[model samples]
Target chain A: MNSASEAQYREQPAKRLRNAAIRRTGSSAFMTLLGKECLELLRSFKLVWVPIVFVVLGIMQPLLSYFMPVLIEKAGNMPEGTVIEMPPPVGSQVLADTLSQFGLMGLLILALAFMGIVSGERNSGASALVLVKPVSHTSYLLSKWVSMMILTWGSLLLGYAAAWYYTWLLIDFVDVGPFMLSYVLFGLWFTFVLTATLLFSTFLRSAAGAAFSSLGVAVLLSMLAGLMPKYMGWSPGALSGLAYQAVTSEVLLPLNSVSWWSIATAVIGIAVLLMGSVVLLKRAPAHD
Target chain B: MTELLQVKGLTKSFGSVHAVKSIDFSIQEGRCVALLGPNGAGKTTTIRMLTGLLAPTSGEVRFHSLARGEDHRSLIGYLPQTPAFHNGMSGMEYVVYSGRLCGLSASDARKRAMELLERVGLASAAKRRVGGYSGGMKQRLGLAQALVHHPKLLVMDEPVSALDPLGRREVLRLLQELKSETTVLFSTHVLHDAEELCDDVVIIRDGEVALQGSLAAIRNEHRRPVIELKLEDAPHAINWAQSFLQKSRTDELRYSWLSEAELQGNRLYMTASHMDVARQGLMEELTEHKVPFSRLEVGYSSLEDLFMKVVSG
Candidate 1:
């Protein structure tokens, strides 16, 4: 018993030294891992295809909105003299419509793409190989998170810029300030969904399961917020709705108490989810 | 030599299923050790725990050179049974990436990766995607990645078990060369592979250590005289062989030298304590009983025989 206690006492300093070493090299390892993740994304053509898909989704909204009356007139079987009356679409409203398209199809694509970010490596046992090195679990998880954020933000920026360009060419001009503000809101909502997906991926073994469960939770939250605006006004789910309102109002500063509440909630939710994922990753850095 | 590492009562349990029971062993520096076990005997589980891939339910693996509780992984180079890599990355990229993860600078990682790839005979295929690598190439690439940091202890799980004979020979030869340079702890079910490369052997059965010692010591301790008689294919010879076992069981003084005897078909096999006395007694009995025997041979028991007995019993 005395020897056992002495052994434990001797271990404390070594444990501290080991942790110091991990901390010292942790950032470099994270950068290397982040580079690898980005490289993988590029090699797999996900970086190109995902942004392209977002761009197509973004462009389709303004194109379809601009030509909706004509499409209706052409598709509807009416008399030769039949004329459809439709209001000229507002530029901000069309941008909001683009955000809605992103809210649906764009979020789905991001969720699916990010679903396998961690689970795929864990499943393929590739993560096991890396984790066995002197790499820290926090570094591994954070690297994935950072690279994912880069992809999500980059794709969203590019796709929204395309939408803004097309909206200006075909429709009325939108205020850049309000348009960018709404873009942040939309990005936050997408961030929430992606964060949830990442958390699920780190904990769950199946990539498909991670994707579906996260999507399911996002859908549920959005529906709940939509159903009860007064009660669920501060929920992260309200970010999408706030984004639409911010764009449609054409207000340069759309910072209401409710909007601030929702943004804070979303930001907090993202932090908590990221922290949870890091914890999960540390506990089971590799699952065979 | 000094001790390199020690495994103290390491155990693992997955809910109700115990994968590895309490196991204890130590490895000395610069020695090659084999964790010999059959399939499902927890060899992989033990290796995982030792390499810090899997958490042990109880007990610990301690590296002697460092104080306890240090991250010994920096000193350990691990290769899984069926190593999986990012199939999209080239062999060179993967090794360099591994080196970087182990805290090497980009330039150093590249240089080391180049050196190791050439050493593993993978320099020619370095630019090829790992997905295109054959089994032997992948195994060699696995070795390169594991060695990127020039680890003090190299751990491998069933390193050559999944390979064809040609691939197996290639890896075995590599391991033979590597064992001289670093402390190696590898698991294998093949006794011949263990005997060929390892200085120490730890045989496990059902997640428990059956026996463990230096190979020379185990060989010397378990060696015993064995005799075999190929009898004529006749009713009289077969009957005599059958009664021999029963007689040895009952008659103590005359057959005391015979520790065990068994007859299969017309052949008789026996293990004896004293080879000369047992041979003399058998020859006299055969002549007196007029037992028609074709041949008689004497030899010593091998590690294979001991392994079979320990695993089966």
Candidate 2:
């Protein structure tokens, strides 16, 4: 009885055949996964709050700079007319402070929010289900990276825009070229941190460990570059300092030789990080 | 019937520890096969390897279908022991997302998502977040998503083990229905479940195959001549049984017909190479020793008895 039905059942064959598995173009899968991940970020409220926090952080630094002199003068007991000659701060200086603020608070918020990208799915066994469906590890990891980029870049842009608006209103007008250069360079630095977080997320089972370790790497990179610039000039960490240099310096001299190497190395770092994540994920999909 | 999946020389090792030793098995198209084993018997490990979640340390898994040279995953659907889903997404959305990942177009995925949701009795809960779902509901949703792409082969790991009795029964009923549609391979420790729903059983023990064959064939092949005796609980009767077991163990010539025997409390279960000679020898010894016994029954050994023998020996 079973065999009779089996023969008849063979008539239809499987609907998916002959490149059906290969038929799924990389783009559609990427888009679908990217869309799915974005929705998850939104549903979790990370999408809304991360950027909002960035905007607030961006606005705060300039406002604080504008108000610090008055607060200082009022607080100190001094001769009645002794006025501290406080020239209005430069817009470039205020913007650079804003990027530093992003370097601190922005990385913190992003590290906390995205620390669980792969680990959370793995711990929950959700990846086990999604992974079984012919999805390539490259596609999976790439989709995640793309989504994290959306959040990181989106927050950076909104935050930078907010900072620009305030600096223009409160301080002098900064150059569009320097501002854009600084923005790209800072964005690259943020990308490095995001990739590190994702890599650590895949490597470590504990979400806290992943977040802390990635943040630790970010901090160490930044500090090492700060301590020794010529030696660590090409390191991805130097990109942030270069971004600060781009806006504050009269000419883009440091950027002439060091900037390209730093940008290239940072891009390469993101690529290597993603590749490592894909390899690790391919080795064990269920987070064990 | 055509063979749908071929697993050959399958071995998995974690450093120095072997999780699954060299094993070979094949799943025939349109037949339900159960990979049956006890806990820690490498059942889950084998299922994971089959589903591509874990790479085999040294072996190959081949899938034969209309499409050749494919990644082999497109032809298969898998459900892990515990099905996990994004808690934030609604059931309907999750299923559609799964379908899309499997290469279905947007409309096709949406259509199948709705159809499978109703089929799995999750249509009412389709719009609700998966976080609010019950264990049974999550499992049901897992099945629906697994079936969405019409995979040629379906593999599951302990599908019903995490469910309540009612949920277990419900999933079992669904499995019964699903087995008729596609080749189903699932791992489970429950012998009764394997016996109830599978056409073939592959029993593994300690990372190797203890027994693998059609259920009916194994039942017939392992059936052996047996004798069961429930003696009186008196000391003398117990002593006699113990002495007989000791003699059977130490002196084979004196009890050569007894292939195996064990004494438990006041009862004895014994199997022999020759039933008549063993019975005659036992009766004479019983008469000579003045053994007290309430009942003496003879019957064929059950599958549980075979299972115990295979597992223990």
Best by DockQ: 2
Q: Please estimate how well model 1 matches the true structure, expressed as its whole-model Cα lDDT.
A: 0.90
Q: Which ten residues in a row have the lowest lDDT in candidate 1 chain A?
A: A250-259
Worst 10 residues of 2 chain A by lDDT: A12-21
Expressed between 0 and 1, the share of native interface contacts present in candidate 2 is 0.86
* Candidate 1 clash pair list: none
| Cα lDDT of model 1 by residue, A1-288, tens digit | 999999999989987997776776788788899999899889989889999998998899899989999899889688899878999988888888888888888888888888898999888888889999998777788888888888898899999999999999999788888888888888888888899999999989988899999999989989999999999989999988888887888468648798789899999999999899988887777776
Q: Candidate 2: where is the Cα deviation over 4 Å? A: A1-25, A73-82, A250-254, B66-69, B234-236, B246-257, B274-285
Task: Give candidate 1 regions above 4 Å deviation.
Answer: A1-21, A253-258, B250-254
Q: Model 2, range B185-280, lDDT digits (tens) per residue?
A: 999988889989999999999889888989999998888889889999899999889889999999999898888998877889999778889889
Q: Which candidate comes out best when scored by lDDT? A: 1
TM-score, model 2 to reference? 0.93
Superposed Cα deviation of residue B157, candidate 1 (Å): 1.0
